[model samples]
Target: MSLQPPVYYIKSEYIETDTGNKVSRRATIAGPQNIILGGKTIISSGAIIRGDLRRTGPGHAVVISLGRYCLIGENCVVRPPYKTYRGTFNYYPMKVGDHVHIGAGSIVEAATIGSHRELIGDIYQSKFTIIKDCAKIADNTVLMPNSVVPALAHFAGAPGQFVEDLPESTQEMVEAETKSFYNRFQPLES
Candidate 1:
């Protein structure tokens, strides 16, 4: 399969960083300093990244870390997972590996999402969920808390369950698709 058609956004609505990150002005990103985008990532319009929900400590902390060529689709909400430990509620960091895509309107509170994974549109990933590499969460799936998605699995349905194993070519396919998505996402011509 080939890349999708180009997605054009209004230039004034997005800020393209030197590292080729395209952040939409309409997106709500809390605590910018606490969030790290590795490069060539896209934060689409209406997406909300909660970097303010950080680990409770005395020192500086990174709340969210996203690797290269990732996409946070429109209206998605990404926040660090939190839990009570030692009688204290605390939020932990969220790490997303390279070439990952969180699809439109998805809500993610995952602790770690591995490389080349795709969380399809409208997915709800609960706290502390760990998604391994090359996994695909089907559209509208709802993952339970503390869920662990194995590598090369395809999960679907509410309280997501592994429905099938993905092909070995998933990694290459996902990488190419993510790269293509980034390349095609451009500002409208003046």
Candidate 2:
């Protein structure tokens, strides 16, 4: 299976990453393919991935790996491109773990945003903003680059700071709720 998105912009065509997989973008991708973007992965119309992917350099690549049932808000920019060097531009790969939710208009540029977190902001700009799982980011909060948010905390405001750590019990509740949601809608058995 090829994980490399085309270097150009594509519109309106449902794209399934694997070839010969019955689950076409228009059809249902099942089995091993069903596990990845095979089934529920939807790139809305006018959504462009790998726009002008640089063909050279070690890091001039865009890698987006979203776990099952992860929804990317419309008009959201995940891993936007940036200049890496004189002639070698690089595109940050958005590495989202399982069951994550990125608020609409929040820009996750080259960062490791953990699972089950809600990052709300007009422009969430950061490189390597490491937010642990089960975190809640308040609206319009600006998370500075290189910020590390521990798991199960509430964050708000510019350069978001930890307002509170979710008690272990609360964390367990969040995890349980999320697990239920994912398990219920997980791609039906092959």
Candidate 3:
């Protein structure tokens, strides 16, 4: 059976960059200079990216770095994780690798989210969480602080835990899905 690509009829809500990054005008992006979007990433309406939360005592810091073909769904908040060290609190950088999809209404304060990871709707990823490559976080899941999700694992529940191992084809599947999603995201014809 052939699968159909999802279609979104977004009007003139998004601003497409030269590098193919589509960022919604309604999205609240703090400190655009401190955020690096690799390419072909989509930041939907109401998404908030807190790039102003930078590390202390740094000349120049990248608070949030997102790789190619990433999707930050509507109303999602992406913030860097912070911690205290030697009586000084500092925000750490958050890195999201290629083909990552963070669903709508999700709040992420993760240190690292590896390539080909999919986080379903309404999920909360706590500070210092590490989600490895090809991992999937189910809808409404909450990943506790400092949680580590192994590669190819499917995690779910309030305090997310490994539910099962994903198929070996997960990487390819995610890559194709993300690419297709990006391609199918279109501006509605007036």
Candidate 4:
């Protein structure tokens, strides 16, 4: 089947990406060529993805690969690693998995952010915020750019530092949350 988003959640119709993925019209996705959004993902209003600052390449090397069913909240900025090496400016790639929810105003500039992590903030401005699986970033915690956060941890700080590890061994909480939310809009058979 084609990688376009399913007709299920078309209720909130917004701007359709070139790949047929629905994104908020208010979202700012610069350089769509460098961004790869998996099917059924929701990018809310005011989100920004800087795909324009990529290095030259042969194939369509995606700078950001967001997996299916991922959610990017309002005002979030997802961009690749940017650095000026020897006066040469280039950006790295960023990969994200399913069921990952990034909240408002968060800036993600990491190489990868795993699944089941819910990062909530009012205005996340980071240069390199790397979040692992099953992690939760609390609200209003500004994360330093280029910081790596491990899995199953709960982080909080003015600049958002690692606070504590999650006691749960598995990702039951995340699984339940994603499944239930998705199942709600499923059309019932006649």
Residues 12-119, model 4: lDDT tens digits: 446555654558777898988777888767777788988877575556454788986677877888878777778876667888887777877777776778888777
Best by TM-score: 1
List the lowest-lDDT window of 10 residues for candidate 4.
1-10
Which ranges of candidate 1 are over 4 A from the true structure?
1-3, 60-62
lDDT of 2 by residue, 1-190 (tens): 4333322323224343442111223322222221234224434332223333433655444555665445444456665435556666555555666556555566676457676665554547577677788788887788777788888898888877779877666445544544443344223223
What overall lDDT goes with each candidate model?
Answer: 0.93, 0.54, 0.93, 0.72
Model 2: how far residue 27 lies from native, Å: 18
TM-score of every candidate relative to the true structure: 0.96, 0.60, 0.95, 0.77
Model 4 local distance difference test score: 0.72
Steric clash pairs (candidate 1): none
Q: How does candidate 1 fare on TM-score?
A: 0.96
Scored by lDDT, model 1 comes in at 0.93
Residue 94, candidate 1: Cα error in Å is 0.7
Q: Rank the candidates by TM-score, best first.
A: 1, 3, 4, 2
lDDT of 1 by residue, 106-155 (tens): 99999999999999999999999999999999998999999999999999
Q: Lowest-lDDT window of 10 residues in candidate 3?
A: 3-12
